[model samples]
Target: MKHLRFLNKYFYKYKWWIIPGVFFVIISNIFGVIPAQVIGHAFNLITENIQIYGLFSGFERREIIYDIFSYSLLYFGALVLVLYLLRGLFLFFMRQTIILMSRHIEYDMKNEIYAHYQELSLGFYRRNNTGDLMNRATEDVNRVRMYVGPAIMYAINTGVLFLLVIYAMFSVNTTLAIFCLLPLPVLVVIIYFVNTMINQKSEQIQEQLSKLSSFVQERFSGIRVIKSYVREPYTKKVFAEESEGYKQSAMSLVKVQALFYPTMLLLVGLSTILTIYVGGKQVINGSITPGNIAEFIVYVNQLTFPVSMLGWVTTLIQRASASQKRINEFLQLKPEIISGKQEKRAINGNIKFENVSFTYPDTGIKALRNVNFEIKQGQFVAIIGRTGSGKSTLANLIMRMYDVEAGRIIIDNTYLKELNLQDYRNQIGFVPQEVFLFSDTIKNNIAFGLDTVNDNEVEAAAKNAAVYNNIIDFELKFETMLGERGITLSGGQKQRVSIARALIKEPKILIFDDCLSAVDTRTEEEILNNLGRIMNNKTSILIAHRISTIKNADKILVLDDGQIIEEGTHNELLQKGGAYAEMYQNQLLEEESQSV
Candidate 1:
């Protein structure tokens, strides 16, 4: 009933079509009931030995036969014509209604799911499979559309037909009608049990299918790495196992379906046989006329179709229920980060972190502990740390990807939480460690967020990032199409493009998280020098492992185990012989030895 309610609103919008379609359906069914009357009346006319009237009522016996033939042809022809025309009309509207309903539901569902994704914290995406989200957005929504479109209409039609046949049978002969329906109660019970089993099995099948989709997506995306590591056989073996599980689950569902259809057929057939035998006896005993018996038999057969369709409807409902449950569960997930109910705040990039502590949602392990930092307006600050030292976590906090457990982060003298997230983030730009680009032209990627920007500004940003020459080398230049994830570009080119994209935003606060790692030392130096000039008065945060990357910064912070151990200029840190001093000495020795 809850799922049905979900479809009601959309159904109402197209009720005009449905109402007419249903009226046509009823007209077709009424016409279908006529053939039985014709059969019974012809029998009576023959048995009674009556002088059947001709077309004019005063005609020869040959004319009488011809009249009967013509009347019979007209009766049958009218039934066929009405049924064909009305059914075709109804079918057209029904298809249109279904398409309209499915498209509306799909559009709404996709937007709702995407909105939820946008609200959810980064932790949710990190723990969940990308393919699973894709399936929920695409496959699950489609399944729900199937239910809304075809399943609902079929359910309605089946119910109408079942009741029509039952009423017709009762009107003809009550005793025989009751006897014909004796198997119905038992059949209902059996169908209920089968439907329950089907729902359970179908849910499992869909879950396994989701897993299979995820496996395929993961493998395909990482195929390069798998081949590079020479793990083809191992990956194949894992995928084979997942595929086999999906196959086995599907077969299990098939087995249940096979049993259900046969049971339905047997029940319907038995009811039909009962109607024939009992009604035949009634006719011979004069309890009812031959015509009545003939009509009863026709009605009984009519009932068979709806009964048989019950199995298919049950299967559809089961699949729909499974899909609905998955979609509901996804919608119910609460994002780890919550948006505040306040007006948008104007930012000038004065950031201060006071006693911040953080933990990942999945593991609840502390990623940062009592970390404190501050950057005055328009300052160039660098963060240096070993791997897993919570350097990225700090950046994530500043970006508000995850909320801190205990602390306050202030931006431009306002609490971070008391600002509209989208508007606040619009003032900041981040270039992550691993750059990702959409499969679009280079120009669009650079000006992604903005609605409109001149080509001159885009060119300027590209030149500042030192990738203008590379872009011009290609035939399409800025209009060149990059393959998926920027696969057409080398690693260094992709990184520089990402940098240009972030820089073009002209954000007040710019973050480069290991963005220079992929380029050669000379290239890295050139980019750093260019960035220094571009960021003269703009607030910037540089995260890197190399001392040279942070050498020109106003201040550098050395982090170890989530806490800042040292903070000073590069020369000041080297003179102290601390953690920063030790790292600098090692890199200096390595560089000198390589040069020799």
Candidate 2:
């Protein structure tokens, strides 16, 4: 019922097209059955007139036959031509309306799903697999469209054909109709069992396909690691296992379909044979005219078509139902994150974390616990911590990526949740450790977040990030197209491009989350110098492991185990000789060793 309601919205939106298309199905089937009656009547007229002319004495039989039947033959031919032409036109309208409506609905559905994905929080994506989502968006959508267009159209056509043919059959002789339809109960029993099997097999096939797709996508995304570790054979083996699973599921579905179609065709043949035997006896006993027997045979042939098509239509319905269920699961999901009613257009970036603590979903361990910090507007604050010390987690909380499990983070005296999500995020520029670049021109990537791009502003941002010279060295300069995830560029270059992306936003708050770790020391120093100038009136938070990057900051925070053990100027932290001093000394020794 839920699935039906979800699909019904689309049907109702395009009801104009669907209703007329269905009406034409009825018209075409009515016209279709008329031909059967016309042919039977013509055959009877020819045979009966021959017997009547045999009693003529003054005229030759041949002359009487030609004179009596030539007009009727011409009339029969003309009537057939007109009827068939109208039927063909109706079929064209049905296809144009219903098939096109299905296509439109598919387009609308894909867009809606994509929009919904954007609305979903990061936690939703974390819980779902990319390839599985892709399968639901694409393959499942196509299957539903097939149900709407070809499956529904054919089902209706078959139904109308059966109804009109059965009426025509009963009109000629009720006893013959009863005998012809005797195989229906046996066919219904077989179809009921067959449909159940098909439904189960279809669901298995779809699940196996999603798993195979996810396996391939994950393997491809980590191809670099696989090759580095020489795990090609192992990866291939796993892929083969998944592929075999998909193949087995598909064969199960095929097996059900194979049994169902043949069984239906056999039953249709039985019904036709019975109709012929029963109608022949009625003609011999003079209970019905020969013309009526001829018409009954035509109706039997018409009925056979729908019965045989029943299995295929059932298969389509089962597949569509399964697809609808999957898509509805996505559609029904409400995002865990919701925006606040407050609309703050300008944020001063006075951030204060008051006893904030957070734990990731499905994990009992806390990533951050009772962390406290405060940064005044336009202050240069740097956070230094070891791996897994919650440095990144703190940054994530500042950006409202996830709400803290306990306590609250405040910005400019307002709680983080109290500000509008979009308006709040727009005021900050964030560059993370893992830089992602799209497969587009460099200029486009830098200006991606903006509605319009000014070439000069992009170049200036690139210069500020100390990568302007690198851009000009390329043949295409700013127009150079990047490969997937900027694979064509070096790590340092990708990081610089990401920096430029954040810089162009010209945000009130700038965050660098170990973004310069890949760049050479000389380039990193130059970028920091330019960033220092840019951070004059904007609150800047630098999260890094290297002490040299944040040594000159106005204030430094040393975090260990989600607690801030020390907070002071860089020189003050060194004077205290705590975790911050040890990290700085270790990095200095490692650099000296590398130089030697």
- The TM-score leader among the candidates is 2
Candidate 1 deviant stretches above 4 angstroms: 1-28, 42-63
The top-ranked prediction according to lDDT is 2
Give a tens-digit lDDT track for model 2, residues 344-371: 6798879999999888885665788888
lDDT for each residue of candidate 1 in 1-596, tens digit (9 for 90 to 100): 46545656656776776676566556556655666666666556555534444333665676767667677767755765665576567656666665566677778878988998888889888888988988888887887877776777677777777777777778878989898888889888988899889888878888988898899899888888998999999988998999899899889989988987888778778877887799889988898887776677777677667777778778888888888788778788997777777787667889998999888878977888888888988899999989988888888989999888899999888888877888888888899998999999999998886779999989988888888999999999999999988999999999999999988888889998888888888878877787888777889999999888888899898888888889999999989999999999899999999999
Q: What are the Cα lDDT values of the candidates?
A: 0.82, 0.87
Per-candidate TM vs. native? 0.94, 0.96
How close to the true structure is residue 521 of candidate 2, measured as C-alpha lDDT? 83
> Local error of candidate 1 at 296, Å?
2.8
